[model samples]
Target: MPPADDIVYLDHLASTPLDRAVLEAMLPWLSATGAGNPHSGHRAGWRAADAVEAARAEVAALVGARPGEVVFTSGATEANNLALLGAVPEGWPVVVSAVEHPSVLEMLPELARRGHRTAVLPVDRDGRVDSADLAARLEAGPAFVSVMAANNEVGTIQPLDELAALCRACGALFHTDAVQALSTLKLDMRGQGIDLLSLSGHKLYGPQGIGALVLRDGLALRPAILGGGQQEGRRAGTLPVALCVGLGAACRLARQRRDGDAARLRLLRERLFGALSARLPGLRRNSPADGLPGCLNVTLPGLDAADLLLDLPDLALSTGSACAGGRGGPSHVLLAMGRTAEEAHGSLRFGLGRGTTEAEIDRAAERVAAAATSS
Candidate 1:
């Protein structure tokens, strides 16, 4: 294993370094040759519009959705807000999983203020939602249900198909925040029965500030943002041509390399886990063994995760959700999975990426184990 001073990064869940191919694809759009405005009928504008449409088709292909169904948003947060707020009628009840991102959690207050009922479905010790409980809630008639395809903190893959079926049986719409699952899993929008799906570009080796919401046809909801007519009036703003191009290219690359990437990442993850567990006998893995391919959360009992992170500057990692960074609180996801406050506070998340190598994983495990023991 290499020395800890090498500065290996393993926080891909927080964000990924942009792929070179994606960056090159976006470069023309950022320059004068790119479309100035997609709305214009002029040659430059039409060319830009053509680029945007091409990217849209690429994004749609990755998820098995039509180009028309993909609505560009600022990121997954905006996409989630659009999906959740747009799908329901005024004053209807809503249900979301307990382990959802703060964007979804924060929206509950506004929904309540608007006289809409909200229910948070709980998860088991493994951080998986109870389908029976979800079905029961749906039977009570919520307008829609939101569940993440995979957890960001603990990396538990939800039974999206079963949940979608339950929502369908009750005639409710189903949405998934697939920001963390985009490159890690195979996404089939129609096959999964997902009425709405949110994805972030930065999470999949694309540029930030761009994402998309895939909505089923004829699903009506009010627009969250109102401005110049864009994105077919579902979302209103000037399209981000460069970011869109990057996202589309990243999606295409991911589709091409998904199987090979998953196999390599799984091997790296297991080796890291096995090495760390052997070095530190009391170490516990927070993520499920069968969860997403490249994410792992582990708890080192009696060690403060924040302290461990700060002490190990050579390793870039996270205590839990990067969205909760600077908040100084235990992970809500870990708590939902039955971890004690101390246990939750003792956790760290290691998210592997395309650039991560087996040697890097081994070195990271050794450094992490050393940090845990010293702390």
Candidate 2:
């Protein structure tokens, strides 16, 4: 790893550094004076509960959902688990895209074990879930469908509106893991026909360990974490006030800044892609043209991404999902997109974020070029 001060962090999909403003909002709750369990009824507890509810409203606003619909969880992983495992009833079918994050993909076995029939929806070469394939899957009468709003690996934005419509037509509840999409996409839970949605704080410059699942009004879910009947019995736990405050602050900022950030990041992403293409003529683009503004996945032909990244210590990049790291296998996303294992091994994912700059993009290009040529 590069020295902290010297590293060019291009792994925003893995996690983002907490925004200073978000931290400021969290600090009061993190202090000793802020100690209070939101589940309690005393004065301090009431104050904590108020803050948590306020944060819940903020998170709800980001997704255009009612405040009462938000159910806070540990993170998107937990949210995904809750949506997949809790929403679908026994003996009912559950379907998810092939390229879903591991949190969602890994639930198939458990869902199967719980007596729910699980199915995988195929994606196109650009990592998009084909609506036609989804339509066919819907014919099987899935009780619930979980598709991501945007992919974390290739950054491909799925057609959630269309997918949700198809699910609605089939009378199947739809859920989306919007953890990566919230940074650039505008989400309206009601307008999109999204029955459930999942998001994480750290993906968007908020504190880690804080996330929420937004359920459509009147939708019911079985409790995944049973405890004190918090969150109206949908989820049960002592809410983390500090993390909730940070997530709310981040969501508020995201609503205000996403459009401007998307425009700026798109140009920077193109700049980096142009720079890299000019340097390495044979590199293959993996991310689609209309994907996330700051995501650029590419295959450096004839080179292993792990080896390449090892040589460029100052440039923080990844071969695939952070969750899939150290698993000793090729990217399941690439394989799902029909790329060979060798091509998956040669792939690199560049995730620019709020802090990325043109100069850093150029320098990263130069470093990657040098490393690729030498290899």
Candidate 3:
């Protein structure tokens, strides 16, 4: 690994550093928490419950949903499990996009095992699913459709509004994993006809171990955890006051800074690309033109991204999704987008966030270009 001070992080998609404001909001709840177990009947419990509900309202407002619709959970993985496994019926037909995060993709197998029919909606080379295909699939009237607001690996923003409208017309519920899009997109669930939305706080400068599944009013999901009756019996657990406060603060900040931050990130991304392109030959950009401004996925012909990352330890980057960790393999999203196996191996994902600076992008590009070419 390179020297610690020289390291530049380009993997915000995996996780973001906690915002100082968010930490400040959470400090009271974490330390001398006058708020006790939210489930209890005492005054302290009432205080805790109020804080949790306020946080829930903040999250709901961020996504344009009612406060009652948001059910807090451990993280997006659990939120996804609650959406797919908890909402879909035993023998219903479900349509899911091919390039979704593993949280949404992996749930299909369990749905299939439970006798629910599963259909994978394919994407074009740019990793976008045509609305015509979605309309045709909804003609069969599947139980629900799950598409992401933006892909985690390539940052391709899907046509979620059209897909949600199609599902609504067919009387099918629409679920979206908006964890990646929360920081970059203005997600109005009502306007988009989205019935459910999944979120993870760590994706947007909030705390880890906190997420939410937002369901439409009057819609009930089978709870993954069954114990004390909580969340109107839709989900049962004691909510963590500190993490909830952090997530809410982060959501508020995201809502406040989205557009300006996106423009800044886009400019920095272009600079990184330009700098690297000047030095590194045969660089192929896998990210689409309409992709999120913050994420840049590029492929360097003949250079294994894993090997390059190992060689350039000064930069914190990714070969694929962080869920793949250091195991080293082709990205499912890249393969779904029609990249060959070798192309996938050579691809690297660079995620930029609010903390990212022009200086870091320049340094990272210079170092990465030198390292990749030399390797």
Q: Count the backbone clashes (under 3 Å) in each candidate.
A: 0, 0, 0
The TM-score measured for candidate 1 stands at 0.97
Give the per-residue lDDT digits (tens) of candidate 2, residues 1-375: 657989998999899889999999999999998999998989999999999999999999999999999999999999999988787766778889999999999999988888888889888899888889888877767568999999999999999999999989989999999999998889999989999999999999999999999998887699978868888999987889999999999999999999999999899999999999999999999999899998999999889999888899899999999999989699999999999999999999999999998889999999999999999
CA-only RMSD, every prediction: 2.0, 1.0, 1.3
Off by over 4 Å in 2: none
Write one digit per residue (lDDT tens) for candidate 3, span 100-173.
88888888888888888899999988889899998987776656789998988888999988888888887888
Ten residues in sequence with the least summed lDDT for candidate 1:
1-10
The per-model lDDT (C-alpha) reads 0.89, 0.92, 0.89
Predicted candidate 1 versus true structure: per-residue lDDT over 242-268, tens digit per residue: 999999999999899888888888988
| Best-to-worst TM-score order | 2, 3, 1
Clashing pairs in 2: none
lDDT of 1 at 347: 90
Question: Which residue pairs does candidate 3 place in steric collision?
Answer: none
Among all windows of ten consecutive residues in candidate 3, which has the lowest summed lDDT? 323-332
**Which of the two candidates, 2 or 3, achieves a greater TM-score against the reference?**
2
- TM-score for each model: 0.97, 0.98, 0.97
Error of 1 at 300 (Å): 0.3
